[model samples]
Target: MNTCFSSYRSLFPVLGDYVHLASCSQGAIAQPISKAIEEYHASLLSVGTNWEESILKVEATRKKFAEFINAEPDEIAIVASASDAISAVATTLSYHHTKNRISLTDLEFPTAGHIWFAQKHHGADVSFIRSQNGMLPLEQYEKEVTECTLLTFISHVSYHNGFTQNLKKISNIVHHKGSLLFVDAYQSSGQVPIDVREMNIDMLCTGTRKYMLGIPGVAFLYIKKELAEQLQPRHTGWFGQEDKAKFDIYNSIYAYGAKRFETGTPCFISIYAAYEALKLLLNVGVEHIHSYLQDLGKFTREFGIANGLKVATPTASSMYSGMTPFFIDEASKVEKKLKEKRILVSSRKDVIRIAPHFYNTKEELEYAINELVQLVK
Candidate 1:
């Protein structure tokens, strides 16, 4: 066990009760996050919904998430979910004759494809790059993404098989063709170290419900300042305006930078929880979390393979995210059985996802795997 990382497990009381390895679906709630929720409730009862304090928390959380991704606070928009963020960006695109193409792949989490495809009515020509043999090659992007390609959607890590992508390499390919890149980092944000500037990302979105250790209502969207300034989102509201307080019915003036993408009042309670949750990640450091997960992911793959289980995650450790899935018969049923045994996991289609965090111990993983082997056999 990595004592330095595993010691933080004490902060999550659920870990002491259950072998919680479902960070890919919903992270185990930490004590600080619980306390933060309590504080929100208490404030609601006392102050009776203070907008001033809520707005402060919203900005604070936004700033923390920006720091997490090495982006400016002005570049980050605190939206409802990754879906909402992606949709807001989608509406801003022109999709005219010149740059009418939108490139995507099969690995995206349905949300990207659904949102982008809907733009077909607006003169958008959407195309998909095939992920040959469960891997998305850079050459595929080079071949499919032409000068007419307006935007290319890339999942930082595949939710199905934990196949991580090289953002820097992909970004280079997208830029060479004069197109924009939008990354869905929901699977990789907290567990993987991401520097948007270093990777030359044009836009990105991630939700807090999974590895971010926060709740479902809040998500962060990062758009480069230069790009954000040019976009005018039609799917916007009062909050997206320069002055959320001023009720100007005649004007549609958007807020400066990424804030322009925000719509209506955000979920303040989730903002409170997200603020504390990001603090925990920043305190521990994402680079260290990535390093620890690398070894843990390797263990999970090897152990599953050794136990006669078909590990479906990517072979290389570097490509592994926080989750390691296995191709099992009746995966959803197996997930229920694991739950009956006080072991939690996630199931999607034919695979059972084993998602761990920095606090998960080696013994816990071994025990879970051992129990999983018994159930499947």
Candidate 2:
């Protein structure tokens, strides 16, 4: 654990003044990200433009992303946002044009829910497996995934309650009924270690802004190699073509692999930043990061309950995660007070969320909790 801390700590520049506990919303900007962007800008200004160098840098970025997620480099495609990634994959699924139903959890993010909902206009049936108090029941999901279900879309981690769903179990259940599992991994990707091959995820999409520690405009999508050929690109541009730079007017064949998802001009700046951010996380090691996060979550949960604050996340270490949601009578007031104390936390509905990353120390958690105890009192 000490070794993990030492390695992980090196990736983040110390923000000594503030105790940042909002990694679920947005991660802190790493120094490497800033330096990478500066170097990229300088490259743009140098010489009579080096197209090959630019493409190689972008490819290297994709390789870094692939390594981070344990995916093939060719299976990754850079996109504008999580929504774009979802829409690209969701719209391409041939089931969207059919009358087959789509299953999703009630606690899904708006982007995941809306993308599936939009397909209803085209004659698809979308059903949300009702979650009990934002907690998804495995049996309920099993019951809802029927023969008519063409796709099952779910958030790997609930943004509101911080519940991490069992994707492997859910995928198996869905696949048995001839349905594909499309996961919105935005909340869980960077903080958690995800292996798509091990989980049998047909399609997964996530943005870099949150735990990924990148700028907001960058995201990526992973399509299982087998499913890539089945998806008919609904939104395609020159970038998706067999030869992106080719000016041929007649031939129109989409590129193989995930590159087919990208539509037009890429957000090069965000991509560059995201690449560096992913590289930093990869160096830190995902398993180490996850263990550190689990410890942080445990510490936060214990401290919150020891005080007067009501703990909203599961008390068990196995069930809970880095995101811990707590509650106080006056959530708004508590949030304001914490902000004044240079402690950051987000309020969702009646619950106050304190999500910290690997870099955050136990001492910081104690400080935040102490402040919360005072606010609640």
Candidate 3:
């Protein structure tokens, strides 16, 4: 057991008996997250409302998340979901003229396609770089992302097969063609280390439900400071104004930085949960979490292959995230059987996804894999 992470396992009581390998779909709940929820409920029950304190919590969470990604606090925006973050940036883009192409790939979660494809109504030209055998080729970006491409949206890690992209290389490709890079880090954040400045990401969005160890209803967005100042989001609301407390509706001046992307009041309870979760992740350190998860990922793939399961995740360690998915018929059925045995996993299509976090032990993974193999056979 890694002594550094082993101590943290006590914080997540679920690990005592159950084997949770579903960090791709949802992270196992921790005690801190539970306490955060209780604190929110207590405030509400006692004071009737906790708007002022909750807002401060939101700012703290925003700053923590910014630190998590090595971005400026001003560059971060607190939104309801990754979809909402994409919408704010997507809607503000000018898709009428020469630079109207939105480049994406097949590996993206459906939400990425749904959001960008919807931009066609605004005269946006959306092109897709099809994945070859569950992996996208770097040359595909060179071919598809042309000079006219405005933004090339990519998921840092694929939700289907755990295929992770090379952000720095792709950023170079997109920037060489004078196109902006928009990364959806929902599947990568908390499990992988991301530095917006080092990666040269024009925009990025990630939610805390998965590897961040928090509930849904809150997400963070990072936009380059210069890029954020260039345009105003069409999806702005009262909270997005320069002075949300001013209540001056006549002249609408958007808030400076990525805060302009925010809409109405945030999900306060979820924000409270996110604050503690972010603090926990930061304290543990993303670099350490990534290294531990990679070792687990390798263990999963090797064990599955040796057991005759057709693993769908990339064989290369660098090209994959924490998720190790193996092809199986009736995957959802197998997932249920595993759940009945107190081993939790997630299934998408014909593959059962086994994603582990830093808190997971190799023995737990072996047990989950052995059980899954038997169920599939």
- Which candidate comes out best when scored by lDDT? 3
Worst 10 residues of 1 by lDDT: 313-322
Please write out the lDDT profile of model 2 over residues 205-324, one tens digit for every residue. 999988888888788899887778666798888877779778787888878888878788777777789888988888777788888898888888888888867887654436566999
Q: Which runs of model 3 end up more than 4 angstroms from their true locations? A: 1-3
lDDT of 3 by residue, 302-338 (tens): 9989998999975644597888999999999889999
Runs of candidate 2 exceeding 4 Å displacement: 1-14, 45-52, 96-99, 315-317, 328-336
State the TM-score for model 2.
0.93
Runs in model 1 deviating more than 4 A are 316-318
Q: What is the C-alpha lDDT of each candidate?
A: 0.91, 0.81, 0.91
lDDT of each residue in 1-377, candidate 1, tens digit only: 55687678889999888999999899999999999999999998998877888888998898998899999999999999999999999888998899899999889898888999899999889899888767887899989999999999989999888889999999999999999999999999999999999999999999998989999999999999999999999899998899977899998898999999998889989999999999999999999988888888888988889989888865644567768999989999999999999999999989999998888977888999999999988
| lDDT of candidate 3 at residue 146, scale 0 to 100 | 94
Q: What is the lDDT of residue 225 in candidate 1?
A: 96
